[model samples]
Target: MEWLERMNRAIDYIEENLTGDIELSEAARMACCSSYHFQRMFSFITNVTLSEYIRRRRLTLAALELQHSGVAKVIDVALKYGYDSPVSFARAFHALHGITPAMARQDGIALKAYPRLSFLITIRGADAMNYRIETKESFEVFGIEGIFRTDGDGEAPQTPAKLWEQSHANGDVKQLEARAGVLPSFVSQDLYPVNAVCSYRKTGPDTFPYMLCAFKEENSNTDGYTTVTIPAYTWVIFPSEPHQWEQFGDTIETLYRRFYTEWLPTAGYEQVDGVEFEMNGTKNGLNYIELWFAVRKI
Candidate 1:
């Protein structure tokens, strides 16, 4: 459980610095992974963004202090929690505890509490994940991309989600498909060829670069698109069991959650520094996507 131990050390760093500036990159270092991977893994495991978790923790500590310390001023508590002013503090406090900070000091008052978080092993069910490993030559893809920041202060970073919405709304999705020629059988016909591409090497720390791209063949139009080459590497591709289009988001979330929590801990390979693919395809009259992870032998 070395990986989990490293993760806990990162959490310890956050808890110690909750009232001060938290360096997300340091947390990732403590966990022995990139900031991008740390944020994503934390979200998948906890079902909450790192930022939201931090907010709840700060509010939880504030409530406890208010309820017990008679001399602790509300404004002081707000300041201690890094809130700029009382009004902003109160708003955030009320959102979490359903009562004003002053009201928290009253007797018989009830407030919500979010305890510190830690990870441990559990008996996961025997659900199988169908995956294949392959090493292919370098390939190029062309599409539009957006720069997204990683949430380092335990905040959730809005990302690929926003990119997906923009592409769909702006007709980038339709345009890419119309420009695409004949694709391999493995390619998805339901939504896109490649739904989203995220990786560690193509960008900087504290930043996640995502692209809504498709396989760029020779003579593929390069205008109005950014072309990137995906270097050759061993990939572990997990093909999701087919399900309705309505279940797309839920299905993908489940797949990620399981991969990090259940599979990686025991797998013989470790995820390396490279790009990941969310490839779209269809099966059983439904939609599916293959999760392509860059990996190397552990």
Candidate 2:
């Protein structure tokens, strides 16, 4: 199946199972992508977390059921939508629609509706997207790593910035740069920050490791840092225009949005399970970066 078709089918699956327990793994499976990639891509494309989307959807349906079915009790509606208790259901409902179930059922209450989502590819003017596909052998990256979670507003939290500050203050970045055997020219290059998942477990809060790293050999000295092995995989590289240090964050976020919504659907490749990295550097007095996404041909 095509990438678009698979994505739409995933949406269909979510709609069908909204009232039941939905697993991120199953949703990604329906979309033919890994859970990590699916969640990231879904958030980038829709600007909402997967859980938030599911919650809004369930609440929307629950509100309708409560308003229309005069005989249906609030507890029945809540349980039907997978809420364990009426209290929990009312809390979530009020949070989303700004009104409780009883208020919604009253004469003149307005309830917000989040209709089901369907995706379609629309063509605008053809603006060239600069990227290259390349396969590399396995490699290792050594650096300071920390865990960060996504905020409620769908923004990556400030934990990563705190990690970088700690690393810089303690001279860990310099230590890793001096130990670099490969990419020496860019070793001390403070531009690129590599982010990857050591392991993805499907329970609890969503979090992942973000690393400030450089290329290292297998026999690199064990010091005050950690190392992660990146297996061989094909990568799609998106290089950005030169920008100032302050603009780096916004630039990368824009690139991600473009990658998911504009590039991947037409790039003739599907994402694979592997590490993603950013290559940062400076040229002609302007800082630049490149995003690398692991993928395989569809």
User: To one decimal, what is the Cα RMSD in angstroms of model 1 from the true structure?
Assistant: 3.3
Question: Model 2, 44: alpha-carbon shift in Å?
Answer: 0.4
Model 1: ten consecutive residues of lowest lDDT: 151-160
Off by over 4 Å in 2: 145-162, 181-210, 218-220
Query: Can you write out model 2's per-residue Cα lDDT over 1-298, one digit (the tens) per residue?
Result: 3888988988998999988877767777888766666788899899988888899999999998888877789999999999999999999999999998988787667999998888778786788788888878877777777665534233434566666677778887667666664453423344533333333222223445567776676545647777777778888888888899899899888898899998888878887752577677786798887788888888
Q: Against the true structure, whose TM-score is highest? A: 1
> Which clashing pairs does model 1 show?
50-154, 50-155, 51-154, 51-155, 188-281
The candidate maximizing lDDT is 1
Q: lDDT value for candidate 1?
A: 0.81
TM-scores for every predicted model: 0.88, 0.83
What digit string (tens of lDDT, one per residue) describes model 1 on residues 1-298?
Answer: 7667888999999999999998888988888777888888899899898889999999999999999997899999999999999999999999999999999999999999999999887887787777788887887777878767775332333667766786788888888877665564444455455566787354677787778887887646668888788888888888888889899899888878788888776676667753688888787778877888888776
> What's the number of clashes in each of the models?
5, 0
